[model samples]
Target: MLKHEKKQYKKVVLAYSGGLDTSTIVPWLKENYGCEVVCFVADVGQEREDLDGIEDKAKASGATKCIVKDLREEFVRDYVYETFKTGAIYEGDYMLGTAIARPVIAKAMVACALEEGADAIAHGATGKGNDQVRFESAVAALAPQLDVIAPWRIWDMQSREELLAYLNERNIPCKTTLKKIYSRDANVLHISTEGGELENTWNPASENVWVWTTDPLKAPDTPETVEITVEKGVVTKINGKDMTPFESISFLNEIGARHGVGRVDITENRLVGMKSRGCYETPGGTIIYKALRAIEQLVLDKNTRLYREHLAIDFAQLVYDGRWFTRLREIMMAAADEIAKDVNGKVVVRLYKGNIDVIQKDSPNSLFNFDFVTFGADQVYDQKDAEGFIRLYSLPSRIRALNEQQRKQ
Candidate 1:
C-alpha cells in the first residue's frame, strides 16, 4: 500500500457520476487524504436512472455533501450548438458527445470547488485515457491554484478486481458487478461504449453493447421522413414543432433511435496516443449533422463551403483534445460563425436502415439559381461565355503540356 500524505487538503470536490469508479472514489478520497470530499454531479442529460439515489450514495460513501446541478440546457445551447455550427466530427465520424460535454462539466466542478472553498479537485478518469487530460486541463485553465489529485496515478490498485476488493474492505457500496463491466459515457448528444469486448478490433459489437439505438436490421421497413428547420446554422424546429435546443435534440434522439439511424464502431486515435476501440450511438446527432450539412449545401457558396470543411477538421481535433476553453477554440468558433451567416434553411431527412437521407432542402438564403441551372434556353446566362472561360480555366494545363513537348524536342 502506497501511503498518501494525510491532511494535505481540508476539502476536495470530486466529479461524481454515481458510477462504480466515482462511487468507490468518494470513500477512498476521504480515507486516504483525510479531507472532506464534496461530490459534484452535473446532469448533462444522462439517463435518469444513473442520477437516482446518487446523492444518497455519495453521502453514504462519506461525502460531506453531494451537489447536483442540471446542466442540460446550457450544455446543448452553448457547447453542443457551437460544435454543431463548427461541423466538428472528430476523426471523420465521431460526433464528440463525450468530448463536448467535458469542458462545461469541468467548469461547473471548478465553480463548486471554489464556492465550497476546497483546496483540491478529483476525478475518477483513469491515467491512460484522454478524460484525465480533459478534466485537469480545464481546471488548470480556469483555476490554477486548485490541486488535482489523480488517484489512478498514485494508487496501487491496478484493476477493477483490486478496486472492488479495496471498496469491499472499507465497507463501501459499489453497484457495479464484474459481469456487467464495460466503460460507458452518455449525454444528450450520444452514448459511447468502450472496454470489455470492445478491446478487440476484430470483434464486432454485440447487440447488448448498444443502449440508445435499435439494430438496423431489426428496424421497421418503412422509411420515415423528419423535417428539421435551421436558422443561422442552429436547429430550431423538428417535424414542424418549435423546440429549444435540448428539447429538439431529445425528440430527434427518440425518432432516430427507433429507426436505427446512427451507430458506429471505430478504433479512434485517443489524445493520449493510444488507439481505443469505441462503439458510439449518435442517432439524434447524426440527423442534425446531416440536416445542417444539407442546408449549408444550398445556402453557402463553393468557396465558403470548402473553407468550412477544412475548418471542421482542426475544430474537431481541438474539441477532442480538450482545448475548448482556449483561445484557438474561440478563433475557430468565430470563423465558423462567419461562415454560418447564410446557413438558414429547412431539411427533410428520411431515416431508414441506419442512414439519414436528405429528401428535401429549402432555404431563403439559398444561392441556387434555377434559371441559370436549367437546361432550357435561358436569358440569364450565355452559352458562348463557357468557351472563353474553359480556355482560361485550362490555361495552366495547356501551358504545362506545351512545356513538356518543348522538353521532348
Candidate 2:
C-alpha cells in the first residue's frame, strides 16, 4: 500500500516582520519541511527603529533570501487616504490603523511570491487574530491559486513562553520575551497593544505599555491650534506648509502625539467568537478622523450625510474584518468616494491635553448659509413656514384622532 503523501510546496514566500513569530517561523519552516523560505517585508511607514536591522535577522533565521520594499508612499496615498475619505471610524474609536494596512501588505506579499516563482505563501498571523482573515482574504480575492500556510494553527508551540523557549533552544535570537507578552501591530496610522494587562478590564495600562504618546497629565497645559487644508478630499496643507501624503501624516502624528491626542481602550468583538481588549494609540489618525468628519458636515447635504453615516458603519466593519481587496469593499469604497466628492475644506483644530476639537471649518462646497439660519433676520427662509410644515407632517395622526372622536359621539 502506498503511504498517504503529505502536501509539499518546494518554495514559499513568507511575509516576514522580523518580529518574534516570524523570526521563529523562518527557521522552523526550513527544519520541518526542508522547503526554501523567501522572506518579504513591506515598509508601510512604521517606526524606522522597529524595521532597522530586520534584514540581518531574516538572513540569520536561515531564510534563503529576504526582500524589503518601501511601500510608504503607496500606503499613504492609497489605503490611508481611501479610508480617510470615508470618514469611517471603526467602533466609533478605532482608526483601523492595522486594518487599513493589511490589504496593501498582502498584495505586496502575493506579488513577491509570484515574482519569486513560489508555490505557496506563508504568514505569521495567528489563527485567533483578525490579521489571519485579512491576509487570507486579500490573497483569496487577488490570487486564489497560491496555497496559503499559517504556522500558528499547526505548530506545537501553543503559548508565547513555549515559542520563546523553542527559539532559545535553537539559538535563534528574538526580540520578544515572556514578561511583555502583549501582541502588538504597528503601522503609519496607529499602534495597537493586546493581551497582558490589557486583557483585564479593570487593570489600567502599565506605564511601559504605551510607546506612541505621552500621558495626558504630563502633556502641555497650553493648547495648540493648527490649521489644516484639504483639496479634493485629501489633506494638502498642515499649518499652511504644503506637504506630501507621507509628510502630512508623519507631521500630524508628531504634533498630535505631543498633545496626547489619541488613546483608546475598549473591549471589541473579534471576528472570531471572542471579545478582546485592546489599548490603541492612534494620535494622528484621531485628528484626521475629526477633521474629515467636520469637512463632510461642511460639504455634504443633510440626507447625504445621514445615508453616508449609515454606510460608514458597514465600511468600518468591512475594513475591520479584512475585506479590503474584495469586490464588496471596492463597491463600498466607490460609494464612499462619491459621498466624499465634495468634502473639500479647511479646518482649524485645537489640541489640548488629549482633547481634539474642531473649532472652525469652511469649505468651497459648504451648504451652510449663516444669514438663512440666523434668528435675527433671514431673506432666504420663512420661519412661519415651519408651522405649516409641522402640521402637514403630522396629518395622519391628526386625522385619526378626529375620526375616533366622531365615532364615539
Candidate 3:
C-alpha cells in the first residue's frame, strides 16, 4: 500500500487493547510481516469487561504471547497527577484522558519489545487520528533503533466493515458489529466516544454514546458534597480516608458519575490538522480539577497564578502534541512542580446534575487575609495611604491625560 517496501523483522510487540482495531491487528501483523507477534496490554484502569479473556483473545488471534502490565497506580500517580499539577485542559474541556494515556502505553510497549528481543513495535492507531502521532513519537523518543509498524497507514483496508471482513475471511472471531461501531478509549480518568453518528456535526449524540455517566436530567435532585485533601497539588484523600492516587480517582469517579458531574461534547482540532467531534466523560478528573483550582485560589498569588495559567496553555499543547519525553516537557513540568509546592489545602465541593461548585476551601498558605480588607474597619491596612498608592499606580495614565488637556488648551 504505502510505497515503502516491507522489511523482515524477527519479532514484533504490539500495543494491544483487546478492541476491534487491535484484535484485528494482532493477526494482520503476523500475516503481513511474517513475524512473531507479542501483544502488550497496558491496564490503565479501563473497564474490567474490556480486559476479561484478553490474553486468550490475543492468543487465538495469533499472538505468540500476551503481556498485561498493571499500570493503574503508575498511571494515576506519575502521569495523571503530574498533568493535573500543571492544570492543563485541552481546548478548555477535554481532561486529556486519552492523550495522557498514550505515552505511558507507548513506553511500556517499547520496554516489552526490548525484553522480548523484538526488533519492531506496532500500534493500531489510525493514520487520521492524533494517536498515530502519539504512539510513533514516543517510540522514536524512547527507542530510536526499533522499527515502528503502523498497519492503518500501510494497509489497504479503510473502513470498519473492511476490517471485520478481513478478520471473518480468516475465520477469526471479533466482537465488533455494524450496529455498534462507536470508537472508544477508556482509562480510570475518563472514557471517550467517537465515530458512528458523531461524524455529522448536526447529529446529536445519542444516549448510547455515553457509557460511564448518568444523564444529568435523570440524576437525583439532591446535591452531593465531597471533601478532598490536597498535598502538593495531588489529591491525597477523599472525604476522611487516605488513598493512593488510583484509589482517590476511583472513589471520586463513583460519586461524580452518579451526579453526572463530567460530560463534555466538543469538536477539537487534531494534530493532523482536522476537526473531530467527540463526547468525553471525565467524572473523577473533573472533581479533582475543581478541588485543585479551589485550593489554588487560596494559595497562589496574583503573578504566580498568572504564570501557571500561561504555563497551562503551553503544557496542554505539549501533551496534546505527544512531546512527553522531550526536555521541554521536563522543563515545563519543573515549573508546575514548583508551583505545586504551595498548593496544599482542603476543598469541599457540591455536585448537582452535571455542575460542580466549590463550597469551601482552606489552605495553610492562603493569601486571603480577612484583616487586610474588611468593611468593618481593619487595622492591618491603612485607608488614607490609598490616595498616594492609587496616584503612583496610575501615574502613566495621569501623565497622558494631562498632556491631552494641555494640548487642548
Candidate maximizing lDDT: 3
Q: Summarize candidate 3's per-residue lDDT along 1-409 as a digit string, tens digits.
A: 3346888888999988877788888888887788999999999999999889999999988899999999999999999999999999998988899999999999988988999999999988888899999989999999999999998889888877888988898888888786766888899999999988999989999999999999999888999999999999999888889999999999999999999989999999999999999999999999999999999999998999999999988989999999999999999999999999999999999999999999999999999988886778877888889999999999999999999999999
- Which regions in candidate 2 have their CA more than 4 angstroms from the true location? 1-5, 403-409
Name the 10 consecutive residues with the lowest summed lDDT in model 2: 1-10
> TM-score for each prediction?
0.97, 0.95, 0.97
Q: Which residue pairs in model 3 clash with each other? A: none
Candidate number with the higher lDDT (1 or 2) = 1
- Write candidate 1's Cα lDDT for 1-409 as tens digits: 4446544679999999887788778877877787999999999999999899999999988898999999999999999998899898999889999999999999999999999999999999888899999999999999999999888877787877887887788888888776664788999999999877788888888987998898999998999999999988899988789999999999999999999988999989999898999999999889999988998989888888888999999999999999998999989999999888888888999999888899999999988999999999899999999999999999999999999999999
The true-versus-predicted C-alpha distance at residue 245 of model 2, in Å, is 1.6
Give the distance in Å from residue 82's predicted Cα in candidate 3 to where it truly belongs: 0.8
Candidate 1 C-alpha error for residue 383, in Å: 1.3
**TM-score, candidate number 3:** 0.97
